[model samples]
Target chain A: MGRIRLTLCVDDSHADDLGDIAGAARRAGMTVEQELSGIGVLTGSIDADNLDALRAIAGVTSVEQERDVTLPPPGSPVQ
Target chain B: MARKSRKRPAKKQAALETLSVSPPEQPQAGGSAPATAPGTTGRFLVLFDRSAAPQAPNTLRRVANLSLASAADFEDGIVEPEGLGGADAVMLPDLAIAIASAPPEQTHALGVASDTGILAIEPERVVYTSGQGWPLNTGPAASADDMAPLDYLRGYRDAVNEVYDRLTGQHDAEAELGAEAVTAFDEADATWGLQATRVVSSQHSGRGIRVAVLDTGVDSGHPDFAGRAVTGASFVQGESVQDGHGHGTHCIGTACGPERPGILPRYGVAHEADIFAGKVLSNRGSGTDGGILAGIQWGVSNKCAIISMSLGAPVQVGQSFSQVYEHAARRALMQGSLIIAAAGNDSRRPARVAPVSHPANCPSVMAVAAIDERFAVARFSNGGLNPQGGQVDIAGPGVDVRSSWPRPTLYNTISGTSMATPHVAGIAALYAQADSTFRGRVLMSMLTQYARRLRAPARDVGAGLVQAL
Candidate 1:
């Protein structure tokens, strides 16, 4: 299965324990990238087949595919 | 004064009650009624001094023998007209105003009761709109009635012109010179966006407030921002906070450049605001959700009052917003930080309109649309096309916007919803500085509430163009 980068939102109840949620996510077949404790979010990569496993982790409210943003070239008139 | 009862007959009371409950009656077109004088309902509007509002009911009873149904007596202060049975007046305690139908003598008595706190008494008038004028008789027209339609058309045209004049401050003698009134903004001394948003006349300078611009980065070495306190951090990996791409510098320039620049025409908004430049995107103008979220976390941790993001990836139609972003936005608001983002510039206009881009599509994040100097929605500016969590919050001047750019190119003029996002961010800083209490969700609401209403649809302009304090 292909690996997909994702952003996981921690539940409010587990917001103070982002470290524990990150640990849980790691055990559920995810490569932890960043732990954004201020906003209770974790970014990582996981196998497509193991998506349900990551979602099923305790304190993980949502697991969304990361979206990329690109602006127009500097020389472009409309930015 | 002695209280004397002047009870109305039961039949007359019922008629008055019906009149109060029913919509205002439309006068016949070209009727005998004088055109200059406004049509009045039999009821009078009574104004009371604020300090005297609480005693209004008792005062009215003592002075004019008029009993009042106080709005405060009802739940949530919602006074139902039909529920105001047998009362001579309905008193709105909060507004210190009253609507009443009383005899001329009683009204005179209330007006003269200075000790009782009555301010003024005036008759309520019948209001009409340009779209729905006094009902015109569409039946067979007589030859003499041909002039009537012409007259009505002239009146409608004048009403529209008058409203436009008031909105754009075109009533001044200088603006009476034809074309200038239509395009009221002149960038002789300041950028057209600043003039259009009333930033030129604003007194607040965003002093003591921290504004975070999460984009590529900012040019700290720029001459315009020489002595300004700018704190910067890079969330993008393998890149320094120094803005290699011009996008971040331009945004920072618009939001917190300088009071007096080396070049002519002021472009920045909050000159005194401390700048927190968070580089979330790479020098190539690209970034992932993780970098953006990290930037947000950094801004929130620093207690930045305003976080402006002029970058977003366009979402497809019927696509729901990211729950992760929405939750983060809510958390930011809870901590007294407002997240503002561009509503995207993927639309072609007059052909196809696109939905607001994400993270902006998140409900908690304010989605700012772009308008031109003429206050028309930009062709590239996205609209709130989706039903779920994709509403445009407000608008700002974006087209032909002049602001700071990287060195060797000190200034640049561009057009996009990207340019508009900083206008809002800058103005929000001014508002935050004006009153320290205005932060997070309250600041967001105030921005919309105080925006100048435009003739455009709410989907295109939201609450209209964002204005300064």
Candidate 2:
């Protein structure tokens, strides 16, 4: 399957070592985009087939497909 | 141990005699028993600053020239009436309250000497049971020869009638006042939302509190925000903090706009709150989870007490909340920041009601639903249909909400869960400022606890309408 953006939640055990989690995630065929250390989250893109590999990483908890939020156009009465 | 009945002083006895003999029809103010009042003991109750409780006895002695018996000296902290003896006051150290038998003038002097740690001084009122019988023995026992059986029965009848009349009269007055009050709030002095939420009467202006509104950026140049402290940042690539879309400015206006706007009808809440505008959503009002995550990180790093996200993606009925977002929210709470988001406007009401949206569906994040001026849940507001984490936390006035918008369109009236989110956020800032320790999860609990419970279901209005302190 083609590549899709994803958000990886880092487990509490690895919150202090986000760098290791990031390195592990990258080695598991995922491209790291942003490491939000404050919230213990890592956002990146990974092939649909390699999702399990990223999930199997020691510090990673759950892997979610990135969702886009779109609001109604400015002229709409209900925002 | 048997408790002994203490004898009333001659001065107090005379005061009580005058109060009891006063006419029932006498006006509460300027009545014959003005000094003791109709339903009050002759004693004055003084509340002292907690830190100054130890000095209360000294302060009372100096201000009112009265010696006080300390409750701490008594066994089990119970200050028996007989133990007071000739002392003019008894101090309950734990509550920092002093029950003193002082003249009105002396109590007035104590009130005026506020710096001496006296916070308030008021006459202690006699409270009666609303039930069938009296619970307190407030006065000396009456001797059998003092009254005939028929006269005693007549006295009891009169006392019961008096209490019933007073209770019913007060109830009628409250009902009349409620009926005369504005049935529906409009934009006369303040927005309907502000009046409905009781923000108009709130004394806390969110002074010195930092609130982060992560949406489109805010219109920093808006005249309503002149001289206000505003910090803006853009997480969206190549986009400046200036709001090209008016949604961010509108949300910010509701959350942190000035107390007195150039235009009529005060619309904003948390008037004095410092604004931290984070542009997670772009000028077109679209944003990715990554950008939103960045905004959360920024808000947490800056120590914002409240981070409001009025944007969210609709979720399917059975979908679970994002674990990443949930973790982020928990981390923010640990860092003393609360994340509040919209419950989405995907519902068509009686026809179809949508589940709370993503991110907001996270249990740690507070999901806000919208209510109209009539206190009815907005037709478009979502419900907590999904299990585990999709519950709505609180509701806010949303429909026809008037607030500041980008210049050229200086103000706009909008309706959405989007509009409602900031009202809660602004009120959260007020709570934060009201107590420095009220942060993160505590602030969320307070909002839900003090929320005015609506007649609607909890699924629609959660803990009900969010209220100000």
10 residues in a row with least lDDT, candidate 2 chain B: B173-182
CAPRI band for model 1: high
lDDT of 1 by residue, B223-257 (tens): 99999999999998899999999999999999987
User: lDDT tens digits, residues B332-415, model 2?
Assistant: 999999999999999997678899999889999999999887787888899999988799999998889889899889999989
Candidate 2 has a DockQ of 0.81
Error of 1 at B35 (Å): 20
Could you give the CAPRI-style class of model 2?
A: high
Error of 2 at B281 (Å): 1.6
Interface RMSD per candidate: 0.6, 0.7
Clash count, predicted structure 1: 0
